[model samples]
Target chain A: EADIYQTPRYLVIGTGKKITLECSQTMGHDKMYWYQQDPGMELHLIHYSYGVNSTEKGDLSSESTVSRIRTEHFPLTLESARPSHTSQYLCASSDLTLGAGYNEQFFGPGTRLTVL
Target chain B: AQSVSQHNHHVILSEAASLELGCNYSYGGTVNLFWYVQYPGQHLQLLLKYFSGDPLVKGIKGFEAEFIKSKFSFNLRKPSVQWSDTAEYFCAVAPSSGTYKYIFGTGTRLKVLA
Candidate 1:
């Protein structure tokens, strides 16, 4: 079946460690997004991309950065992980044809990050 | 910029009970609305969506929602819920353009007891 995939499902690293979370989709969607959440809490938009070579910051201010080098892959990087950065990062994408106020999103299983 | 808000941080219901979750959004122009459910250890999946034409929409697992434009609300409902329905439900909104980036509510954890 087609789906979005997130790598490093679980991660535990020192406060200063650099980390990258990978996301990919097989459905060929042109739009992708990254969200951060504290388990059971609300999700906050951190970054998003329209297509390859296009990216924008979300409403939430996050220290991490994301890149869309390819249409199917949108990776998020934390230059210096902090204890405050401990959270679940979710990856999602949507095809625009689902359009006109019809916002259905396809999400990955999500990557859980822990900063010690 | 757009935003989504979901009330009911946590909900507990017995099997066969009815379910409803509140959702609201802030956007001045046209937009899309959706409901997504995340089962334990699973990815978030779309339950249903309301784009246009109809205000009420039915989704998988017998869940449905109605978009009240005047109220600025899109609420998810299920006539009868099952224990297997235990999961987190999120309401989302997105502007008509851009990357179609979505703004999600915090989420409501629904626990359906057997």
Candidate 2:
């Protein structure tokens, strides 16, 4: 079982409002990632962190910003929400063990965000 | 550029029917392949993965996948599918060079009718 968790399993907000999606893990993983997905579509990487205070932008460009102040918490913030930003956001974390059997990532339940 | 493709966008199967879903990757170098399943209202979970040794890897829930290096294909298969197996399946690949970033396919939606 995965220990990752995300708050506000579903959200509905008006356009231009700022919103933050919360993600946290109890497994004490060193690597964390955020992915965006439209309904019935492939997941696109948006943001990731190697460790506390380390962040990098993923392949697909995203308007949201993420912070890694604590190893267990990685929060994504959208300055101004828009209809275009409506999608399901998934959070995943993986351990730092460098080996064949340890590369699998554990995913959170995901947050379904809707900007009206 | 690395990318993954799932040939089937949606699949419908009757109970006790054999199942196969095609997946191909564009990376030339060695890769680690993974098959993940997402049930309704649930998070993504690893069904199985192929790392190095075996070309055929078995995952949880009676799922298996064969990795063909020459074809750059890792196709998932099940001997017989049940209605409980209905879900969205995703295929992902990551290079073995210590980069943990994964490229995922669009996913295949499986519907099993009783």
Candidate 3:
């Protein structure tokens, strides 16, 4: 079955630790996004990729960086994580066609990170 | 920039009670509207969407929403909600530019008591 997956669903690490959150999709989507969400808060887009090697920063500035080396994988990495970096990170993929009006995003289960 | 607003932060209701969640957006030109629900420990999934045509759109789990263009609102409603309806609901709006960027509202946590 085709689905989006994220590794390390829950993680707890001390401040200044380096971490990488993995996201992959089998749905063969052209568009991928990464969002950061705090408990009981709205999600904020942190990064997005239109296709392989095409990365763009989103509305919310994030300390982490993302690279789309392959079409199926978009990983976010934090060189030195801080306590404020603790949040649920969600990854989503969408198949978009020009003039298609709208497209629904398929979301992953999200990775919850706690930086102590 | 486009933005979305959700009226309620938290709501508590008994099973079988009527439900309505308010959503509003600020955007110019045509836009696509959507409602997404996230159950406990589950991924966020689409409940309904409004692109064009009929203003009233029906969705899974007996959920529906009406797109009132004049009021710039797309509100979700259910005639009678069940205990399983408890979840976090988010309203999103995207400009019809064939892009996947969406502006999401602060979610509303709905608790339906059985």
Query: Per-prediction fnat values?
Result: 0.87, 0.69, 0.72
Summing lDDT over every window of 10 consecutive residues in candidate 1 chain B, give the lowest-scoring window.
B94-103
- In angstroms, give how far residue A40 of model 1 lies from its true place: 3.8
Pairs of residues at least 3 apart in sequence or in different chains that clash in candidate 3:
none
* Model 2 segments more than 4 A misplaced: none
| Predicted candidate 2 versus true structure: per-residue lDDT over A1-116, tens digit per residue | 53999998999999999999999999989999999998778899999999999999999999999999999999999999999999999999987455664478899999999999
**What are the runs in model 3 whose C-alpha is more than 4 Å off?**
none
Give per-residue CA lDDT, model 2, range B25-85, as digits (tens).
9998888899999999889999999988989999999999999999999999999999999
Candidates 1 and 2, the one with greater DockQ? 1
lDDT of 1 at B5: 82
Question: How big is the positional error of residue B14 in model 1, measured in Å on the Cα after superposition?
Answer: 1.0
Looking at model 2 chain B, report the run of 10 residues with the lowest lDDT sum. B94-103
Candidate 3 residue lDDT tens string, B1-114:
788999999999999999999999999779989999999889999999888899999999999999999999999999999999999999999888645698899999999999
| DockQ for each model | 0.75, 0.73, 0.78
Give per-model TM-scores. 0.94, 0.97, 0.97
Model number with the top DockQ: 3
Using TM-score as the measure, what is the rank order of every candidate, best first? 3, 2, 1
DockQ winner, 1 or 3: 3
lDDT tens digits by residue: candidate 1, B21-77 = 999999877778889888988888989887888899989989999999888899999
lDDT of 1 by residue, A1-116 (tens): 78899999999999899999999999998889999988666788899888999999987899999999999999999999999999999998887663355447888989999999
Pairs clashing in candidate 1?
Answer: A42-B106, A101-B32
